[model samples]
Target: MIDPDLPLDEQNARLRAILGALMDRAERGQLPSRPMGQLSDVVALEQQVRARTRDLAEALDKLRVTNARLSQAERDAVGARNTLADALEAMGEGFAMFDARDRLTLWNSQFCAALPDIRDQLGTGLPFQDYVRMVSESAAIDLSGPAERDAWAAQRLQSHRRRNVNFVVPLVQDNWLQVSEQRMNSGGTAVIQTDVTAMVRTERLEREKLLDEQAQMVRATLDHIDQAVLIFDAKARLAGWNRRLREIFAPPSALLASGTPFTQLLNDLMRRRLLGRGNIRQVLTDWVNGPASRPPLGLDLVQEDGTELHLSAQAMPDRGFVISFTDLTRERRAIAEMHRMNETLEARVQARTVELEAARDAAERANASKSRFVASASHDLLQPLNAAKLFLASLAAMDNAPAQSRLIGRVQSAFASVEDILAALLDLSKFDIGAARARVDTVPLGPLFARLRDEFQPMADRRGLQLRVMPCAASVRSDPVYLKRILQNLVSNALRYTERGRVLLGARRHGSALRLEVWDTGPGIPPDKQTEIFREFTRLNPSGEAGMGLGLAIVEQACALLGHGLDLRSEPGRGTVFSVTLPQASAGPHAAPPLPDSDQTAGLLSDMLVLVIENDATSRRAIMGMLEDWGASPIEAASLTEAEVQIADLGLAPDVILADHQLDDGATGLQAIAALRAAHGDIPALLVTADHGPALAEQAERAGVLVMTKPLALRRLRRVLQQVPQLRAGQGNSAPGARRGDHSYWLRAGD
Candidate 1:
């Protein structure tokens, strides 16, 4: 065995030397011989020694490699610690971090720089709560009182536990610090402090500059406006005023400064009576002394020198108010002048109105006289014309030369034209005087169209023009006579103007009316002349073709009277359409068939007894002669007395009495017919009169008398005579003395 104190290298060297010596001796066999057991012990001991040597060598190699790796690891740890320290020192913001257990872990040198009083106390192992407590208590933090400091510490701790938090704090040295905390992924907290003092100072400077500029601008604006302005603060002290206020009030300069009490200025103005004797003083005093949120107030004052001042006060949002004054002297003077002018104008208008009234009265008298003259002239003119027409009719009935007959026919044509002119004039006169009124009737368009077609078809053929009356089954609500006249005028105008092409008379159904249209392919009227055509005697063509140019004038007047809508459309080379719109009406009972003509019904009056009375001798003779011609037995007389005697001597009760409306001695046909009817028991009397006024017609209708205007056509006469028999049949003709009375002496004597 080797000694334990020897070095391992030396012991190994010695063992190797001894082993060599033993091996050499054993191989040479130069030793004493021994037993077999003893030889085996020696080999075993040698093998043991070799095995221990191999084990020792392997352990030594492993120890050397282990020492190399441990050395490198130590160097690496030192380098990493140095790098972390440098990084924390280079950071701009003060930074600190805490571990998962709420113990301080990392910090930069800048940390707690604001709280220098507590900076020395910071360390790696410090708990976050203790760190916040130290920061709150530091004199560097701008916090007051011990209790406030405790509350601040609690808030800081609470903020550090949240996911993310940020706040700003003012430092004692007029500096600002923005602190921000962030949660670490490893369940720690990070805090950052940013110095924001520069930014805060910039914002404050800008705000102060803006307020100064606004004050100057307000001062300039208040001075420029026309109204005097005064501003008071919430404490009822004068806050602002303009130059105009001093000029208007003329108050002492001492009272005009800012902060002057409002009551001082008010009292000065009132004592001097510069504010007039108005309630402006009381109103202003009450509003100023009342609630801050007062209603708006206003007052008007007039000074002794006739100066008008309007004072108005309005509240501001901050419980302040602005009062203003405006001079109203010029405005008041202008209003007074306007009122005076209006009064003068009203008086002038009243005087002019009186003059106009007198003129209107004079015009009315003249118009009345004209109407009377027209009536009188028509009656006097038609009487002789009636007699002459009768004589002409008698001449035509006799056998005469064809030439003589032609002459007579020509004379009759001239007479017919005269009659038409007269009739048109009378119609126009009635329209002028507003005497005509619409008599609405359910006039069937079918019959009216048919009659128009028949009347105009012959003329159309003579003119070589086609006239088309479109079939219409509709009826319309309108005055039958005026509606007929309107359509007649439209159709006649169309036919007259059109040299060729067709004239169409048709109706279209509108919502509640029928638009009766008359269309013609005519030389279309110019647009400018269309309105003129509706004026009297305004003929665009002026061809002198049978018309005096009053047709359209009458149409316009009649349409106005009837309230019919008339529209005309035409193009220069195209066609013309005149449309009349009237309300649609339900179909009414068909009218009675027209009375038969004299030729067809003349025999029906054979052996009919008729009495004729007249004031004009020629009219009486002519009417009596026509009665005989119509196959009637006739008694003729000139007045009521003459008719009674003739009736008594004739010994025949009259079947029909024909009497004139105007008789000699102011007696009328109505009165004569009444006397005769009292004697003859309601005899059917026909009044043949030249007067066609509404009064006479109404009177005759009430007396159960039929009226026919003067210069009547012979054919119409025969028709009326035929109707007399019908009337007698309806009234039942009386025998002589059937119901006699004192007025029936002639009838009593005959009986």
Candidate 2:
């Protein structure tokens, strides 16, 4: 140890040997307090301290490695927990969990959100019973009274106790929810509530559709039956009928309905001279009520015109009588023809049959070709016009230079003129093809006039003309949609022709009819010209006029279809008056009530939720954009199924539905709206269609939907939207819809 020059390895070995020997001596109590012994002891202690420090350091190094591994495991565990929470939050269905103690332990935001009214009372540590009580007291929808709330809750609680059970609950809002409860491994329950309203509505609609198909099948069977079938109730009221009966009797529509008294029907038949030779009163009464008074009866009667009819009656279980009428006129004629045929040649019969078949085939082919050509041409002509209108509307909505804005206005006017011409051509084609038909209903003149006023006001303002619609108290039996169109064309023609004088629209009673008149103080038409004015494309002054003169033609055709009398009076250099005489109808449930006078300028379309089911992307976008400009929330869907998904996903009900008649997938907008209303409450619906005939309007009316024809008039659209009860002022787009380009509709009901 004293020799510094010794080899390093040899020195370290000597030091280790000395330390070991010293430690052994120390262990044997050999180390003394002497300086030399103390120095050796200190040295030995140092060696021992160094060796122990190394061991401690090795242990510390292992502990550090273990700590790092533990930290990573903790991070992974935290990440997993956060991931689970995010997944729960992202679920569309409401999710919640409760521990064995029946206390809420976890829940996604929708868990409480779905409850609506009692969400404030739900949270962790909330007892299941307390939550149930809160729900019973504050639920937005319930079918049971408060008295039964406790009982219902008790039953519900009992159901919850069952492990892994699932059930369904219905909300009074017409919403159905599926509640699934899963037993968690930790003695807890996981609940998932999914909205099944759409599913339930689809099922119900399917069933209703099936029933409708079955009814149609029955109607078709009855229509095809050879014998004319009629049924009268025990009270002798007319009930059942078929096409053959209608053809055989040619009874007036009112006389052949479900509730006409048998006596009245018989009287009408007698008045028409259709009854056969019999004791006038007693015999006919016996024929109608004999099935009830007696077992059954059969009668053969010969009409004054030499037609024979066979009637057989049988009593139904419901005390009604089923009567069958077989026309024996054919049989008698067949007998006569048989006698005559014996003297005829077979060659003549064959020649006549071939000639008739050839004529019929030629006529059918010509009609079919004409119809196809007209339909295709109309669609092609209107498609570009519709697209142009949409783009112009969009451009008009943007902030533009004044001259540019004026240019857009002119373009819009041009588009309107083009559309009108196309529409007129289409209408003419429909009328010629017999594709246009009338559906008679009770139409209130007051409301119809008010709508007319709203529509014509803007046009009148543009021309500095006063268009006034006089008060009306009458309701008429007519097709309101077509009638409105007819009047629109009439009033529009009057406005266009009359330069300065006010256009007056009013109705007057004439016997049992209402004579709706449109008076104009413009240059009077000559008697010679007035007669030809109704002809298509005939105009008195064609110079600087954009009108194609098809308005009067449409009016003439519509009047003919509706059986309305058209009267025109004109004085040279004075004025002209045109009137349509319509049969006045009694005020009934079918009458469309007058619209309330609301400020059209006030936030009419503000804050309204409009679900538009339009297949045309451009039209849909245009409508959405326009509604957005008006501050209405518009939710667009291409089909009913898609609309349903959007409605469900948005989790909000629509106030009104605006749809196009022809949707994709062969589904009508009416069907989509029907499905939505079946799931939700009755929502006001307006159907827009390019189909201009009365057939489309009638179909819409039959489905209880209002028609808004396309190329939609902005003023008319505004007026119709004003009438929708769903629109309310000061509402905002606060749902998921706002981001999806849904705007709001504001309502100004008063002032």
Candidate 3:
């Protein structure tokens, strides 16, 4: 009666319902006896029922097939589970399951491999905690203490539940295993372990190497960095410090051992102003919040042991400040020494500057005094010379007298002395102004020698000394004027110094130079005084003669200007030799002609009319007498006015005109000569001046007149007169008596 299409639960309910209905019908006596026709129908119905039963059996067969399929699925699932178990057992990661009691339930091959010594006990099912203790006690691993082990175990348990624990442990075997644990269920735990010994060893070595490298880098940085480094913890306790810090603060061995309080250390520094004007905590706080609020702290602190330290510190709010202490004793000492040395150097420089300033000031004052002296002396000396010249001119105009010659001679001598002094002073002034330059020219030595002989011959003869000039064939390029002066000074000096014996002037060739020498065989210069002789105002024998002692000084100066070398050789009581070396002239076979003898007397008593215009009557007479004696007609004029009157009124144009340079009317002889020449065209004139001024000579030369300086010599006058071209034969000496009776008689009568 059950529905064959229904599910098992529904079919069971339907079968139950159909059985109850059949029993009830049986109980109800609804039976039918087998009737002959009806019996056949009933049997048919039963057959139908049997057919339904067979259909039901076929349905049960389908259900049996489904059940068999389900059984096969279960078997496959079991096999897969076994395969998983095998796989996990063979894996490098140790797989295990454990109960809540921490008992090892299962372990993989990798776990046994990791702990080979404990491989045989794998199935023993030991507690994980017991295993940890055994390993720790055996020294195979260090878990520190029970507390540490408990912490680790608890962490492992928690990590297992979360499936996050993956850690390794080294065992007796030369490998390590990664142990990962997970809680499988409420009753047990699962663990997976892998052999990661190579990785672990490599990682450990890398870690160690990294640590070592970091240490080395730290040491290198500390050794090379300019700033010192120190580290402290939040407790203000020293944690780490570099070698430089150790050297600065304390010895390496004792640094950590010393339990020195940071506050006490800071107090020492603060007392010394190392931490500025604040407590250590306040300084540290300021540094942390804002370092700009306070000034930098630098201090020198002396320790109890007498060690000095320079301390500097900076704060790191969270961590303690890094304090750097540097030993600065040596540096301080060196700085002190440097400061002292600088002071000494500055003092020396100041002293030297003061000395140099003083020296410069002194030099300036001396120069100023010298200039004043020269100006004053020159003015005073020139005024007297002008007056003497004027008086001499007036005397020369007088009539002739018996004592006139003697009077004129005395005046002449006096004038010579004044002239010499003036000349020397002028030469000295030229040197002072740096105008005493030399004009180098090729001078015929012969003529120079001749002139020197002519000038100094009579002088030497009067002194009873032989004056000779040695013959020289050389022509030298030198300043003729300077050479003449030098030689004159040497000769005059020789004559003055010498009592007897001859004086020789000579020249010789040495190498490419000409050596002009003056030798005197008389009392010589002492060897000690030879060097002094060339100095200005240095006279070896001042008592011997009247001299300014500038002669040899002038020689030296002239020689220097000419670029010549001067040498002096002398032996006391023997002789003195003064030599000047000059550059040689061009070499050649040709030489200059010999100079004419100055002593040769030529053309006496020529037809020469000599006009003598002189302001000094004495000079005019002397000159007239000398000209008449030489057989020449002479005319005399006392002044330019007289000369003009004589020329205009007398209508007398003389062949030669001679004029005195200094006139009574403040007129120069140059003016007198100009007036005379205006009357007589192109007439020869001679300028005679008692003035030793070079200006007078220059003026006369510019006027084309010959110049003769006073104390005029008669010989020089004769020589000058002979140069005149207008004198006719037998006209030179017209009448000595007529000449003497005229100007000479007046000159004598006036005297």
- lDDT scores of the candidates, listed in order: 0.75, 0.72, 0.62
Order by TM-score, highest first: 1, 2, 3
How far residue 617's Cα lies from its native spot in candidate 1, in Å, is 1.0
Lowest lDDT 10-residue stretch of candidate 3: 742-751
- Number of the candidate with higher TM-score, 1 or 3: 1
Per-residue lDDT of candidate 1, residues 1-751 (tens digit):
6786886666666677766666676667645575354456457657755765775687688878888788888878888878887887888779988888988988888887877899899987998778877888888877778997888788777776679987877688778888888888999888888787898677456435543553564576567656899899988899999988888888998998899999998999898888899587777888887776565667888888888988877776457778899988877876685566557756577766676578679778877766555555556667766876776676566444467689878767766666766666666767767666665766778867877897799879977899999988888888776788899988988987787899999999888899999999987989998899898756655322436678888889998888899899999877899999989988664333344445876688898988889888867777777677667988888999999999899876788888888898999999999998788788877788877666776676566666678788677567656766655555533432222211121111111
Task: Report the alpha-carbon TM-score of model 2 versus the true structure.
Answer: 0.45
Q: How much is 709 displaced in model 2, in angstroms?
A: 3.1
Clashes of each: 0, 17, 37
Candidate 3 structure lDDT? 0.62
Sorting all predicted structures by lDDT, with the top scorer first, yields 1, 2, 3
The top-ranked prediction according to TM-score is 1
Q: How many times do residue backbones clash in model 2?
A: 17
Q: How many backbone clashes does candidate 1 have?
A: 0
TM-score, each model? 0.47, 0.45, 0.40
